[model samples]
Target chain A: MQEKELIPYLYRTEFRKITAVLCRLFGIEHITIAEDIVGDTFLLAAETWGLKGIPANPAAWLYVVAKNKARDFLKRNTIFNEKVSPEVQYSAGESHEIEVDLSPTNINDSQLQMMFAICYPGIPPESQIGLSLRILCSFSIDEIADAFLTNKETINKRLYRAKEKLKQDKVKIEMPSGSEISDRIETVLTTLYLLFNEGYYSASRNTVLTKDLCLEAMRLTHMLTENKNTDKPEVNALLALMCFHASRFEARIDKNGELILYEDQDISLWNKELIKQGECYLNRAAKGDLISRYHLEAAIAYWHTAERDSPEKWEKVLSLYNRLLMVEYSPIAALNRTYALAKVYGNKAAIIEAEKLGLDHSHLYHILLGELYATVDTQKAIRHFTAASKLTKTSADRNVIRKKIDKLKK
Target chain B: MKEFVMVYRSELMGEIKLTAEGNMVVSKEWENWMGGIAAQNKLVSPGMRLGNEGRVIKPGNVVTNGPYAEIKEIIGGLSIFKADSIEEATEWAKTCPILNAGGNVEIRDIIQVNG
Candidate 1:
């Protein structure tokens, strides 16, 4: 990369690494400081690199600069400065050199610890998502606001309050041990799941930014699958679910950035490697009889990615959705179950079930109704499509509904 | 300990217009600096970062742009610090990160006034 291009590129990859290590060094309460030092390192690089040109080894240069800033912060402000308050002694052995270890092992450990800390159950789910985006994903305040469709002040306030709550409660930045791991990991996994959905299904207009959010969520989930404390059937299941969904990321959107319905999508655009990875993780997740929602969802998604069109694929999908609803009840999941029902059974049987849902407000509900009614009652289908077109928020959804109306008119 | 306000002002000399990416990283540094003081338990009030552009409402009902006739240096922010004396406060002010960014901090003792 050229000198001007390198800063943003490094910011994307190294921001989380440096911040995690600094949080590990300074303690999670001082995360604002950790983030600050990381930002300063990048800012200084931008300023200096502009004047002096880029360093030969920019990433290493950043690490060294960040370490020095961390040390500088400690020496001037914290307990290390015995001169400021003579009676108080430095307890953490400020006598020894402050080690800002950025080694791969330390970095990974720190990031893992930091991830669990951000997902602490004490924090609200909204705050958890915000913290994950800022720290784990290294999204700037503005970028975060854009993704969530909020302003900078709200994001800043949410992050500040979350960190303060962590400090007040004195939550440790470490992995849970023994049985506690099960509960804690569940929270972490749930947070990651919400984060992925936020990225995948967010109403934000910026498709690229939303995709980044999903990919970042996947990265964090993958981290859990590797750690011993969190290495569970459910974690792998969640990873598999994410992988299966991500595999269709390209196929889901057309060249014009419009959403593509499942049957119409170009299967060739689907990522083969990601689908393979999903299969591997799904197999690993099969060993346990846990039967988490993620395992069921992942199985359903895997079926959707089958190479050839077959009724058997829809049958598998239908059964999994049935199991998933029994495992946990969600209206959206119930709605999805109806779609799979349409695929396995005749539209008449599916239409009978879909009407029971009575999800009048959802544009998706009307769209599904419109589809089911197409063969039985064309007039009803046109009316439902008109209703859906009015309710749909995005032009893409409206576009599909409009086409359906036009087809019925013809 | 005495209470003093450190007013940060900067001409922001040779301020190169930062790219959007560069702009993203700047706010955190300010937060880090303020949080440092608060962590020390010396921060009386975590002061507000002032706006660069403002309109001064004059004695009349008329409004005008610019806080001053000829504005150059900007008052970046203000925060109260607890230290033993003006000298100590000034010493702490010397370490303010704003100074590194072409800014200076003016330390002044807060006088007790009867309401």
Candidate 2:
């Protein structure tokens, strides 16, 4: 790959690995220091590679530089010696070498540990996600703010507060014990799901279809599946759900970056390999009796991957939506179910159900209503479409709704 | 071709608080800029970076703790490059990455004396 392409790819892939290793060495209190070091490593790569060309083994080069920097800092800072050295010497033994080990197994272990540390329950869920995006995914504050649909100041404050909380609580960087593991893993999975959705249904107008966040979420989740202690049915189900959705990534947006309604998307563009992998995970998820929301959602996503015009597909999807709402009563899920309701039952019945949900503030609700009323009542459809256009944030969504209104008026 | 010395001066280099990562980034920028000149066979000498510490001896045999204690700007480093003219050398200096960090490059023609 060219230097421009390789730098970013390495930045995304290696940022977490290097930070995790450094954080493991410096302890959680110095997470920012670790982040700074990793950032510097990338900046170095960008500058050096522009002249020297890409290194033969880029990962090793980063590890060595980061290790030397960390060592230098440790030697110079008396406070680190007093506070951190004892712990490092105890855990790693008295070897003066002070290796910043980034072996494959250690990398995996450190990441898993970092996941637990970031997802500590004391930190609010949104803050947890913010921390993960910043430290684990190598996202800039601006990018995290964009993901959160907020400004940089807000994200910066949130991350600052979260890091303070971690330090105050002295959160350890290790997987939770047996009983605690279940609860902690739930939070971790939720954070991962939100990260994936941010990428899948990105709020930013400029990067609606960027897949980096989604891919990062998937990469972290796959780490859970690989570990013996954390691997569970729900984990597989979430992976399956993500895989199913990712399979349609190509068909989700047009060249103009407008959202493509599922019915209008080209099914031929869906990835067959990802669909097969989703099926494999779904089958594994079905083995256990516990019916988590992930299982239901994965089932719904599975049906979405089927033949678009098939009645059986809609039937299965609608049923899964019903089950999902029973398990978790989110208005968004309820809003989505109304779409499936329209497909299986007629638009008339679905409109009744959709209107009762009282999601008046949501543009998606009005958009769905507009779609449902299109053939039945042109005037009502135009009204709903107009409302949706006003409620929408992005000009892309507004333009889409405006086009719908124009078509109906014609 | 004539030889020119390019001296890098920066006030911000001492004031800016850099983490290890930030230092790496700055180091990479320097490496890339220097490497570009080397690639073009225009580099006469890669030069050395002067540290913050040094001793200065005045003509009266009086010693001071170097670089002038109160000076805001310090010479961070210097390198020599072969260019056809001072204008060509200045053109190359314009691309120096140090300028991005609020630093400036001073280019002077290195006159050759009789051997």
Highest-TM-score candidate: 1
Per-chain TM-score of chain A in candidate 1 equals 0.94
lDDT of 1 by residue, A183-250 (tens): 88888899999999998887787899999999999999898888777889999999999999999899
Per-model clash counts, in order, read 0, 1
DockQ of 2: 0.00
- Per-model root-mean-square deviation over C-alphas: 27.0, 28.3
For all the predictions, what are the DockQ values? 0.01, 0.00
Per-model CA lDDT versus the true structure? 0.81, 0.81
- Model 2 spans > 4 angstroms off: A2-4, A45-56, A78-82, A85-87, A91-95, A149-151, B1-115
